[model samples]
Target: MTPSAVANLAGASPLPAFAPRPRSRPNSASPGPFGPAPRRLAVAAPPRAFFSSAPYQPPEPEGYSSVREYGLVPMVVETTSRGERAYDIFSRLLKERIVCIHGPIADETASLVVAQLLFLESENPLKPISLYINSPGGVVTAGLAIYDTMQYIRCPVNTICIGQAASMGSLLLAAGARGERRALPNARVMIHQPSGGAQGQATDIAIQAKEILKLRDRLNKIYAKHTGQNIDKIEQCMERDLFMDPEEAREWGLIDEVIENRPASLMPEGLSAVDPPHHGGGAGANGRGRDRDMEEPSAV
Candidate 1:
């Protein structure tokens, strides 16, 4: 029952005393005790792809093209105004003897045309010329200049009337070559005396009148050259304001023949025989004719 008696009976010994364990140093290749050091990766990642661009291009040169192998050079001269003179250059290129004069003859425009033709002649001599006229003429001086250029062209010239050639237009038609040609059916040619305004002192007026007379002489001379008619006969015809159809013009020797079927005559220069210049009677009616007798009320 007592504690000593119970222990004696059980015969158990007290707990054994503890002991310390032995220790050793780590190897040289091993990492420190705290933790292993971080390792670096020698990776070769796939190559990257980026966008690239190309350079720009420029335009083509004159008379040339990347798409075309050959191109034609056209010499075009439009006689619309005096200051704007391109037709003169075209005329100068006409080494060909045949030429046609069509449409209204503005002062500056006519000068440019004559100058161009003369320029052509200066480069190369040509025989007589061909003149195709279709117009309601303009300035007297311009018309006269055209006449002179035609007369001195030094070759046999021909004129063909396709439409209405009225007023100073008639003078130009008459200046055609001896054996002039014309279109049949609708062709009409008219001849009337020179007309203009009288603005100046008495002396100036007198001078202007003298100029008119001189122009008349020049016109008569043109008629004489082409028709073999005297100045009186031509003057008489002009005085009454003659209008001739193709047949009448032929009978009067104004034209030699009528060309109805042909691809227009073309000279060495690129000019081709074509229809007469057309003027419209729209808002800008520049070619409308006036009755001279109506203005001469005092004489009547």
Candidate 2:
């Protein structure tokens, strides 16, 4: 063959053949609309309850069905629940021939004092009993109950004022003692006419007002008799609350003497001075202490 024909034949090697790349398969376990079949996962089943189980049950009631069924037990619990310390102190004082009227004068308190006084009087009629008063005063009737009992008892009652004696407390201080009423040097005393509110018809309210006036007159007479003050002057002074220091109280005949130095025997073993006034209803009615503005009339 000629040289040109040989060159053409050499250059005429066939063009290399092209092949398409293979596509990758989708993962069977992956989540997709057009994915391959899913692979099963090995998961353990929950344990059966046949061996041990408890059925669902409703809760029990939280409160009692009838309070009356428990009777006075609940009342006793309630009274002592908050006043355990006071009750303990009171019991100790009673054993020591002492009666502490440390809060407001109230019906329940009067009853308690009266009962204790009677018991003590029965035990030893001639023994000298100490009546410790530190109050802002309360219901006049309740105070009068204690006052009358104090007077009726055969034992000699020595009233001692510590922090304060005001309104009904003043009455108790004056009438609860036999001869001389005493006060701490820093004690305060107050005297005022009985006060209260009446809710009723107009006529009934007027009647209640008249009754209160009459009760006030009786109280004035009692104060006058005890303090040697003229009833008229007492009435005048009592028209508004009159506060006095210990000396002034003594001068006014509210207290016979001011205790300059308290005897060790006068206080409890652990106490230094008088106990601070407890805030809640102590051993008194409504579980509350005295309120100066709300002092009620004796006859109410």
Report backbone clashes per prediction: 8, 2
Instruction: Identify the leading candidate in terms of lDDT.
Output: 2
lDDT of 1 by residue, 188-236 (tens): 8777666544554666667766766777777678777777778888888
Query: Cα deviation of 26 in candidate 2 (Å)?
Result: 74
lDDT (Cα atoms) of all candidates against the true structure: 0.57, 0.70
List, residue by residue over 1-300, the lDDT tens digit for candidate 2: 999999998988588667889888867766787665778898755321110001112333677332223354211111234452223435655766888776666556778889999998998998778888888887777787888888888888888998998888888888755445899888898988877665546676677778778888889999998899997899899998899998998888887877654443354334433343344423323232322221111111
- Candidate 1, superposed: residue stretches over 4 Å from native: 1-100, 122-124, 127-130, 263-300
lDDT over C-alpha atoms for residue 20 of model 1: 64
Best by TM-score: 2
**Cα-based RMSD of candidate 1:** 33.8
